[model samples]
Target: MSISEQEVRHVAHLARLQLTEAQLRQMTGQLDTILSYVDKLSELDTEGVAPTTHALAASNAFREDRVAPSLPRQEALANAPQHNDESFIVPRVI
Candidate 1:
């Protein structure tokens, strides 16, 4: 899991960043350290453990979707600063 100067340079180029030589060296060392830590984590044993989306024992608690009545057009447009017959009028973006 070693990082090279050329790899750092390539990453920097892709990110549109200009790093000094010293910064590149520092980033290389930091990235290598991070990768080494991840490699160490990969050495842990997890024979029968099921893969989970979260670390805790919890599932999604989202409510079921139930379509109902919607707001009236007049009520929905009441708060608008400027609205036409059926749509809002905003300043031109370009």
Candidate 2:
């Protein structure tokens, strides 16, 4: 799909970005180049290729779920800028 200058400008306006005329021209060219490359990619022949979730072998590399020792509450709250009885205190929002 070819992206036109008008279309780019319309998209920029919708995104609430103010683009100069020169910036619009440059962006239009860049977008057109990207779309052309995507068009080239669509011409590849991959009739038997299987869709995959990952590029490498499908295997879990995560550690086993196990309970571990945790720091005490005083240690955890040691670095707090401000704290109440049991939690960090921040400026009131509302």
- Can you give the lDDT of residue 67 in candidate 2? 100
Candidate 1's C-alpha lDDT?
0.93
Which portions of model 2 miss their true places by more than 4 Å?
A: 91-94
What local lDDT does model 2 show for residue 28? 98
Number of backbone-clashing residue pairs for each candidate, in the order shown: 0, 0
Error of 2 at 19 (Å): 1.4
lDDT of each: 0.93, 0.93
Model 1 Cα RMSD, 1 decimal: 2.5
Model 1 lowest lDDT segment of ten: 51-60
Name every residue pair that clashes in candidate 2: none
Lowest lDDT 10-mer window, candidate 2? Answer: 52-61
Estimate, for each residue in 2-92, the C-alpha lDDT of model 2 and write its tens digit.
8999999999999998999999999999999999999999999979999888898978879999999988888878999998759888999
